[model samples]
Target chain A: MQDLGIRVLLEGNNMIRLLDGLWVTVRISLLAVVISIVMGILLGMVMTLKNPVTKALTRIYLEFIRIMPQLVLLFLIYFGAAKAFNIHISGELSAVIVFTLWGTAEMGDLVRGALISIPKHQYDSSAALGLTGIQIYRYIIIPQTLRRLIPLAINLVTRMIKTTSLIVLIGVVEVLKVGQQIIEASRYTAPSAALWIYGTVFFLYFIVCFPISKLSGKLEKRWQN
Target chain B: MSKTDYLLEIKNLEKSFEGGTKVLKDFSFSVQTGEVVVILGPSGCGKSTLLRCINGLEPIQAGTILLDGQSITDGKTKWSQIRQKIGMVFQSYDLFPHMTVFENILLGPLKVQGRTREEAGIAGEKLLERVGLLEKKDAYPRQLSGGQKQRVAIVRALMMEPEIMLFDEVTAALDPEMVREVLDVILELARGGMTMLIVTHEMQFARAIADRILFLDEGQIVESAAPEDFFGHPETERAQRFLNIFQFEK
Candidate 1:
């Protein structure tokens, strides 16, 4: 019975380590999302310009981001590019770089969809008012587009946080990675320890993501009805 | 007065759509200073196209549009300068939805003329009062009825202090009860001696307000005369048929 009590206490220490890892994961995701939104709005606006070559380049970029899996992108940035360029990037830094690239592409597409959904008559009316292109964008276009973009972007942030778990594969000591290490260290004392540690990790992710998901749902419902 | 002394002149204007539909061909006319010219035509007759070309919103394939004797369509024409002197109001109010009534009216002056916020504000308030929308200055376009929105659009155009103003069916979008309110504002503008070219379907407005009227058909001016002469005894069969359409409804 004393041996059983020590095993349970050991499992509790693993749960604490996993929680610490989750803090790192959330930190990286929040920073990446902020950077992505800024880059995405600028890139999306440039993509909508009348230049054919720029438009084609942005199309190719969006397609590449869409087709390449995030894991492959992570490895390419962490292992391949870092070596080829002789640059030293920590696992956390590489995870941020890869996720920022991915999130920017997704956010930019959302911005494009939001911008195009605005009626063309809006432009016509602004032009009729003798508003130049810059005034039209500043006074009329951007505010409306941003208002429609907020909920979608919040949903993307939640997606980014969830996807951050995949970064553990690149050897970042995030929540799942810490959980795995804990289970590996305790394999001898308690075989059932893996289930408890992983269950705790699942709840940790849900705790971070559930509130954002609920916020998105409420905003969508409010806007729709 | 010589035609060259007119406030605006259009010569040999031609426009075509991408699908090869010829909308306007060799359309030409002129408006004198302080004159209200009502352009009468059926739908798809290039009336709106003419207004757009004059404002430099739609580029003409071939033409010369001179405002105050300076050619606006010449390759050397400076758009920003010419646009500063001319203002356009659409059938759809097109008030900036994101802005309050006061901001909407002040945008043109503040941006184009580089008026300070305080200067634009004073001018904006007066224009709003003229349009009888001063109390709704804090309201957005979505908050106002269609007629009120149209009035805001007119005031927004006027805040630029344009040398000439174009009205493209301003009352066409208003409810019948609201039409008179917009027309009353327009008549007051006419009495103020502003140079104006209005495209409208309101026959009574043409009869009561316009100094002269031009009847267009198939993108060509079929007749041009004083409103009394044109409405009383139209020369062309097209003008007669055009006037007949307005009569049939009433």
Candidate 2:
């Protein structure tokens, strides 16, 4: 048990490396979430327009992103596209790009669902009250949409944070990658290190995600009232 | 009546659904300034569609709608500008559920017309007071009873200071006991000499408030007469049959 490499995390600056990895994971996820929300909201609004061309184009893009797995998308950006296009994309940048692509599609669909779920009478009533299209959206539609959107978006943020572990596959050195490094380095001296290191990684992810899930649940309940 | 005296006029109005189901064909009517005109019809007879067309909520295929002598149905017409002068209340109330009653009323004046919150608030208070809902100004639509929601909806329209008001069966969705409160608001507006085109099923309220009643059938006005004449002695066979349904309900 003493050789189990739990000491590797508790003994020295090994834990500091894990904290640094956690920071990197959080930074990428945050950047992705912010960019996704802005782009996704604009795309979602475009999807709501009655124009056939825009509707078809957005539908295709949404389906493409949704159907493709995130890991494949990351590899395409990092390895496949880099070789095909002769562009030197860094692993971190590729991870950010892939996660943002995934998040934006999801966020856009959420926004579209929220916007369309509004009753037709609401639009008719606002128009009859003399509101212009922009005014109708600003004063009536958006306020209602945001109320239905925030909790769902927060859930997406949690999902994005968890999915960041996949970045380690492409050599980004996130928390999971750092845990693998620690386990590999102690393989001979601490033969049982794999279980301890992986357990810590799991604990780290839970600590980050559990509070967010709780917050999302709280928001859902508050909005229902 | 002269053209100048008419607050609203619909000439040869034609409306069809997406699949080419003709809802209104060659429908023509006019409401005089300060007169209360009530429209009565069976469901799907285009009474609601007619009101929606006049408010530009539903675009007409071919027609001319003149509001205060301006061609509202013309291609160049700015519908938002025309809607400012024409207030409309629907059967569903359609109050913004997320907003308080005061916010709902003030939205038109503040957002569309660009008035200050205080200015809209003052006018909103007056309308709320008139409807006896001054205290409910802070309450949301979900908190209000069906009658209160309808009354607040009326006040929301009135906040815009519209020249002509349209009611598309505003009390139709209410409970039987709650219907009178909404009708009372419409009656008050009529007595105040507001120009109104109302669609309703309440025969007693229509008799009390309407200067003229248009009985519609098959998307056309089968009979147009005073409320007493329409109720007591319907002119057309379709009108008599429509009235008989109400008689049976009574």
Candidate 3:
């Protein structure tokens, strides 16, 4: 109690609860990221096609996700849709759905940019070598695109992790929610715990995000050089 | 037994950009086996575009192309398979930057033709040696000079043992000193009896290497003649004017 309310976390199972809360955040984000990456790559390739119908459709999807705020999307899917359709979804499920949709668009656009970023000569030379369209993509285009893509994609993962913090507003008991609960529950006993609690929460997020950012930076420098 | 005497032939070829500007218009030409044909043209005169169409790099607005006396549009002929026989080198020396010279040279033979490493490697190294690039096989494209990279690109094209090689201003992008190094390789190839279609601005080199000279203007062959005649006595006014520009430069 005297030591900046550090005793609150030191007390029975409060630290464990915070860790469990963090796991929820990690679970949702990682699941969404995985799905996003797989679908996003195909979507990206499709976006590069010269077909007009495909162009129009992908543009609308990308624009919709780009224009709408994630918080609003979450409410639309979780609360609005549920009430209108007489359906129910777990808060975690709704969070994952919204994030996956958002993340996929971001990742797809990155992939499309990467594919287009390849020099026109690369395709010409490969085609001149008698590589089929599929073979050209597999042998030359994808490898180069992957080299250009990995660092950016890793950065996207970090964004997803940080963004998962917003899910708590939808009643998901993620780390921030746990921290808030801890602050409210110990208000009388630990009047000063808010500072320490919020500080620890911020520290937790920094630890998770900083290494990912650093890893992406390191890869970018190494690969580009 | 042969359906056509020419190794490569194009009839009524037409190419335009977005149906707007015509790069090539009704071009009809042929390259015989063991022949070296040099195309000389002003900028935007369809010289490079002509090479690109021969290699099937451009979609024809209307035309027929015959390779090795066979119609390319026979439906039985796969374009990918057809391209394997028609090797092409670009002005930029479009080598894969991520690959070493050996990797770049051998990719066509190994991946496209499905040749064994032993078979392709021996041929690849021999061509590298011929181009005076044997020692640079392990070097990446970024590590090589402009001349060295162009030589590697030639080696890459030769690895497939193409029947006819299309050189689209291959030396145009090189420095003055490096240009000779690349032209020397083509000269040696011609001397060795490799049939070649070359688009080049190097007048002296064109005179030295070409069996026939095609003087192009506005997407048509203004004059086609033996190199000696084309250089010494250009037939058409266009050819004379084109050659005069080079003489004035000297």
Candidate 4:
């Protein structure tokens, strides 16, 4: 336990590496979230269109993303697609692409559910009030949809942040990868280094995610009232 | 092109839901400016559908609707433009639940008509004051009673300064005690000389406020007459039977 103290974490610039890896994880997750939200909202609105072709196409895309595992998607994009297309893609870029694809579908479904849950009379009333389609969405529909969406979307964001830890398998050198390196290096000197290293990474993830989960809970309660 | 007499005209309007359930069939009616026309019908009898067709909420398969002699049923007609002059109140009192009463009243005028918030607010306050709900300006719809919500819905429509208003069983969902407040608001609007087409089930209220009553059955206007004649001597057996049902319920 003494060897598992602060000294182990501070050894040979190990702390710096873990911090850098944590930064990478946060950056990737945040970037993916922003992209997913913007694209997801638009796609979700498209999903609500009455056109059968549009609905069918979006359904296919959403189902494909939902059914496939994110890790497999990561490997397909990073290794398989790169080799097949003969294009070079970085590990971090691949992680972003994979997570954005996953997050967009999740967020889009969330948005679609929120938008459709609005009562039919609300649309009829807005139309009767001389509002154009755009005005109706902007002034009435979207605001209500967003209020229903924020808490759920925040939950999705936290999920994305935690899921980003999986990127280490693709060689992104995120926090888990950094922890693995620290554990590998101290394996000879400290037999219990793996426990401490993995524990630290677990705590780091909890430190970031706990607040967001709490926030999502608060928002859900407030909106429910 | 000539000066039109009627504020609204419906000629041979036809509407049907999918799976071949006809809601309105060859329905024709008209309302003179400042006239109150009440539609009386049984449930599923297309009274609500006719009002929906007038406001462009339901597309008609055939026939034309003219607001002030201008065709509003055509594809070329801009619905938003036509809707600007036609206000509607629903049975459900569909006030935007997320918005304050002030915001609900001000939204149509400010967003669609491009009125400043201050200008809209002034008009909104006047309408609210007229309804004696000026204190509820900041109150959300969920905080209001059924009567208050319906009143707010009426004021929200009036905020657009529409030439004509349509009420589709506006009091059907209100509590027994709350119904009078909403009816009173409509009565006040009628007294103010606003042209209105109302679909309602309240027999006494209809007899009180309606200039003429149109009895609809099976998607057709079976009888159109002055309120006194319609109530005193209904033309058709269906109309008599319909009124009898209401009388029995009362």
The predictions' CA RMSDs to the true structure, in order, are 4.6, 3.0, 2.6, 2.8
| By DockQ: ranked, best first | 2, 4, 3, 1
lDDT of 3: 0.89
Best of the candidates, TM-score: 3
Q: For candidate 1, lDDT tens digit of each residue in B33-88?
A: 99999998999988898888887778789988887787878868567667777888
The docking category that best describes candidate 3 is: medium
Stretches of candidate 1 off by over 4 Å are A1-16, A27-39, A46-101, A128-130, A168-172, A183-225, B1-4, B75-77
Candidate 3 per-residue C-alpha lDDT over A1-225 given as tens digits, one digit per residue, 9 for 90 to 100: 468489887778888988888889889989999999999999999999999999999999999999999999999999998999999998999999999999999999999999999999998988998988998888888888988999999999999999999998899999999999998999999999988888888988888889989988898876662
Model 3 chain B poorest 10 in a row by lDDT: B241-250
| Pairs with steric clashes in candidate 2 | none
i-RMS, every candidate?
3.2, 1.2, 1.4, 1.3
Off by over 4 Å in 2: A1-6, A50-57, A75-90, A188-196, A210-225, B1-3, B75-77
Weakest lDDT window of 10 consecutive positions for candidate 1 chain A: A1-10
Q: Evaluate chain B of model 1: give its TM-score.
A: 0.95
Q: Per-candidate DockQ versus the true complex?
A: 0.35, 0.67, 0.56, 0.64
Pitting candidate 1 against candidate 3, the one with the higher DockQ is 3
Q: CAPRI verdict on model 4?
A: medium
Chain B TM, per prediction: 0.95, 0.96, 0.96, 0.97
Per-residue lDDT of candidate 4, residues A1-225 (tens digit): 666545678788988888888899999999999999999999999999999999999999999999998999999999998899999899999999999999999999999999999999999999999899999888888889978999999999999999998888889899999999888888777778777778888988889889999998987777652
lDDT by residue (B1-250, candidate 3, tens digit) is 3677799888888889884898888889888899999999899999988888777777778888889878785557778999999899999988987778999988988889999999999998888888888999898898899999998988898888999999998988899999989988898999899999999999999999999999899988899999999899887888888888877542
Error of 2 at A117 (Å): 1.0
| Docking level of model 1 | acceptable
- Please tell me the TM-score of chain A for candidate 4: 0.93
Q: How accurately is candidate 1 docked according to DockQ?
A: 0.35
lDDT of 2 by residue, A182-202 (tens): 888888888787788888888
